[model samples]
Target chain A: MPDSNTNVIEIRNLTKSYGKNRGVIDVSLEIKEGDIFGFIGPNGAGKSTTIRSMLGFLKIDSGSISILGMDSVKDHTEILKHVGYMPSEAWFYGDMRVSEVIKYAADVRGLDCSEEARKLCERLKVDTHKKIKELSLGNRKKVSIVCAMQHKPKLFIFDEPTGGLDPLMQKRFFELINEYVAEGATCLLSTHVLSEVNKYCKNAAIMREGRLTMLDSPKIDDETFLSFYDDEG
Target chain B: MKTILTKELKLNLKNFLIWSLVVGGMGFVCILLYQSMETEMADMADAFSNMGAFSDAFGMSTLSIASLKGFFATEVGTVHGLGSAMFASILAIGILSKEEEQHSAEFLLSLPVSRKKVITAKGLCVLIMLVAFTAICTLLYCLAFLIMGEGIEASLFIAYMLRVLLMNIEIAGICFSVSAFSGKNRMGTGIGIALMFYVFDLMGRVVPDLKDYLFIGPFSFANASEIMSEIEPKDSSFIVGIILTVLGVATAYWIYDKRDISS
Candidate 1:
């Protein structure tokens, strides 16, 4: 009984903890369909924690989490089918070739990895035959991005997706996201790049110390922000 | 689960080869022990009457080098069985956390599969590896036995090999459960399980009162180790070991399905 126009992600009073250390607390937000959502937070601000919980990778201490209108914990399999995730600290089999790693992921998802992998590799201009151990960090990030996007997921969730990329590649990455959004795909990105946030995200949520400080459209007070960045450049 | 099992089987085949070589190496060493025992046949005959002290000291009293079946039961087969158990332990400890180590956990878990499905797949992989390792060791031992002209009962030998497989499965469950609860302490979990296994064996030997409580041991079939040596056929511990193994796997699944995967 899901509404067709329901939000892609809905979190209400979600809480998580590790022993006595707090991970995330009292976090509530709703990301609508086709929204390019930017999750802006400092280190240990529970950005990754919230993302993990929504993917059913972490247990909730309290509150509710849903993805594509399905309960994250109870309906995880159904929801994950539509979501493509890119983690901040991505790793692959060092002995495996990039192509093989992508194929392995595609095999797990029951998708045609070869065609999609080739297409993504072409788009990213990344060589897929190199062993993961031989690749630099930025190259590795590119591999992860290609793999995440290959399946044409309805919801794309990226955590520090472009941390190691150069300016040119970063720009290309945004272009890819923008293309997806234009095709009506929903995205949630977590990053420290406020400049990217200014350019890419129409809506953003800022967090501090495991709490939500603001959730609003970047279009708000744009004149003031624009003046600051324009003068600095 | 099928995908996980196939991948695990392929990955561990290399490890299984290494352990099989180690077990074969033990057989080579046993040939030296046998040659020396033959040279000292008179002294060994006198020593044989004092079985209790020898069993207590080396657990080798019941083995007879003169007979091929006993030679295998004591030398090559025993080592192969123990080596297979260690191999199973390593796989169980390494598989789940290895994904995290390689940073593949994020990619793997992101599939259209639930956390429960992922754990189920990993558990299945561990079992498949254990079974495949055990089978390869048994085949190698049988081939060696034929070459050595060891005329052991095929049925009894098969039973013995099956016993090793079950014991290995039980140990794998123990190690896997430890691995599942472990976040950053994966190596610690492996070492802890192995240490506890040895400590339990030591306690069973040192304290006569604890002999009946072998259930407390990390491994259920150390008493069966005595049986493998032909010292005593204590069959009561087998059921307890199997039951505990089931419980351990269930607990591992419960914990893994709910716990967060952190790098």
Candidate 2:
């Protein structure tokens, strides 16, 4: 990890739940600028919940999240201005063309991201003319990538971004991410993929049952992390 | 906010057109049939007047069904009232809930726009839709009158349509509030809210004991025959209904701001 004390994201005792369902509990995390921090966990291990709670999509029951040194709740919109978030699933309006969806994303940010979006779409071979419903899962992920990265935000949060991508596309996705990270940006990559964390992330946090069980470096092996979840009911 | 508003308008345009056509087209057809049913309605009007609660419930007692205006009020009135209410409710209910239903809430909320701005944008979409629906249906009704060579009271017709618009806004606001609280499309709940309010008005008119409390429901202000006879019918229901509409929208903004969007 690059030596940087400037925290891009800081979470302290974040707690969120959906009615009777279990959500992240007392989760705390911090990542400095220019760090590719991996958030690894099995399905339903609160990885998404933590990321979403940090993004202010879900109201936290307790604790606080500071993004780019701004409160996630109070300054949610301001935080979003400089952040690019790619959710675990990429589902858009079915009736809209891929081009329209990208336009909509760009329009919301009030930016003409056409140049970046065009290059990304060309690189990913995205059929901008096709309706979103007609696109494959991999293509949808590509569209998500374009929407997220076109603006070139200072911070990037990708949740299970490569699940539906082909091996080549997945490699490309990481490559593009590396280029951005090289530009003094910070990233929080959440996924269940151990290889991605090992090969790409500088550091990681293993979450289990709504809590961060451990925070370690690239040397943290998959066998130990996988065993932690396999041992539980 | 402008971006989302335009997007919502574009997305919801198809459904709006469909609803406007179905409801207004039905009303237009009803007006066309009035001339053919003239003799039948004249006989039925006298018989209906003696039917007590049934006639009163439908406002056939106060307004004679012998004339086109009266017939339109008694027949097409019910159709438009029910149809427009359903349309408005459905539009409002789906405004926010569909984002969650399609699992696009994360994509939408991830933007720099705040929850309040999202609600406001969607609320404005609902308002613009309600207005367009009213204008389209009103134009169709006017066209029908012109086609039939019938002379409808312009002031009374305007008043009736305005009440219907107000009623639609009330229903839409309440359903929009439900939309904010819901994680997915609550079509049934939205329809039920509209139907419940209507049943209350119908029962209030039929049951003498409930008549005084008629102002509690939106239909009380929108009874076509009431507007037909007394163009400026004294009903405090619109005030109550409008206030509730404001409260409903406010509640939507409040709840959506705090509610946890499920993954």
Candidate 3:
């Protein structure tokens, strides 16, 4: 029988370090089927590190990280098929046009990217004709956002997804998140944008100093959490 | 693998067009320099012989003021050794490093393909680019001779061309190996090639008695005057050079396949 739990992502003692510089230590979490999971942290609080390790972008020192129930280090190639990742920086080839960048990404992902690309571009208001170097920072962020969500991946991994977006675009992005969550797919978004969790996330994992400090539902009052943070700092 | 190789070939073609204009144009000027020499052929040989063992040491035996092929062996060898190797190394290093430098490694690795497959594909691309470059250089050399009313034998020409080809493989292999293991791509190619060139030249001077023994060194390989005129490469040295090339390629693939690429 298939496992009914269907945990899309699971981590147990996930740790990484660069020599003496600690990235993350013993990060353990689980996101079951059909959940909007937010990973929150202050700057340099291991949010990107944990997310990158999940995507097999950085090596862990001594720990286990798994995606789609498969071991992360050993089965990353398999995991990638079902995941859509949006990096915080969104650095792309400067010479590539927005359309070419999307097309190239789709090709790499082993998908017929054209139809889906057109739909995403239209929805995201991305002008594919312009070169990436020519695009404004927010526009570039939009292009990356479109690329990440377009394939309808089984899981979406966005690290600081709204980093350069305006308030208007951020609102539109949240609506898109709601629609994605409704479809019973999973989303793991890493950001400092706390308001987003209150607006959409089912639950969130708060991080500090490369460790998980809190994991709870957004149904808790935001003002109460803010007070707890203010008192601690 | 084939797809990645095709992309690499396309990129190298652009590099080739640019370098050919630079190297080939310089080659034409060198040919003019050879023609303008005031000394007669016999007088040149006599003057070279007076330099004793140094003449043989520097490959002055075949350094005629007359033979255009010999002139090319002397001058073009210097030109291609430094210029072409630098150009090729840049492209080869970029094969793996460029993706990471542009933050595309994570994006590319996220594909369905395995990391091993990516490394293999990129390596194949580098190999193909090196072979294509050798063939083009040989063709251009032959064409230049034919156009200039010189009747060079195709077989002999081809044999000399293979020497140049193998020499490039050695340089490419070293650069590829460095790029594979290195986190910093910029330094790997430039430093790798420059170090190889320096080692060869230094060995030629410092260990004067062992100059012939150090044929495996890149400086010796780059010195085309000696390589072109000699009927057979020093057996052990030539074999060692080939072995080094193999070692370089093997080390690169092994390191790349196993190393953690997350960051």
> Using Cα atoms with residue i matched to residue i, what is each candidate's TM-score against the true structure?
0.88, 0.97, 0.89
lDDT per residue for candidate 1 within B141-236, as digits (tens), equals 566555655446776667676767777778788777777777543755665665566566656654678767765553445433354554543456
* TM-score of model 2 (CA atoms): 0.97
lDDT of 1: 0.72
Candidate 3 iRMS, in Å?
2.4
- Give a tens-digit lDDT track for model 2, residues A15-40: 88878888888998889999998888
Task: Please identify which of the two predictions, 1 or 3, would achieve the higher DockQ against the true structure.
Answer: 1
Ranking by TM-score: 2, 3, 1
Q: What lDDT does each candidate get?
A: 0.72, 0.89, 0.71
Worst 10 residues of 3 chain A by lDDT: A224-233
Cα lDDT of model 2 by residue, B1-263, tens digit: 99999999999999999999999999999999998999998888899877889888887888889888888898889999999999989999989989999988999999899998999999999999999999999999999999999957899889889889999999999999999999889999889999999999999988889988989889888999888878454457878897889999999999999898865
Error of 2 at B23 (Å): 0.4
Candidate 2, position A80, lDDT = 95
On the 0 to 100 scale, the lDDT of residue B94 in model 1 is: 78
Model 3 over residues A1-233: C-alpha lDDT tens digits? Answer: 22337888888888888778878889888887777888876777788888888877677787888788788878878888888888877877667788877876676666787877787777778888998889887898898887787777888888888988988888888778777767767889887766777777877887777888666576556665564355264
Tell me how far the alpha carbon of residue B96 in candidate 3 is from the true structure, in angstroms, after superposition.
2.0
The model with the greatest lDDT is 2
TM-scores of chain A across candidates: 0.90, 0.95, 0.91
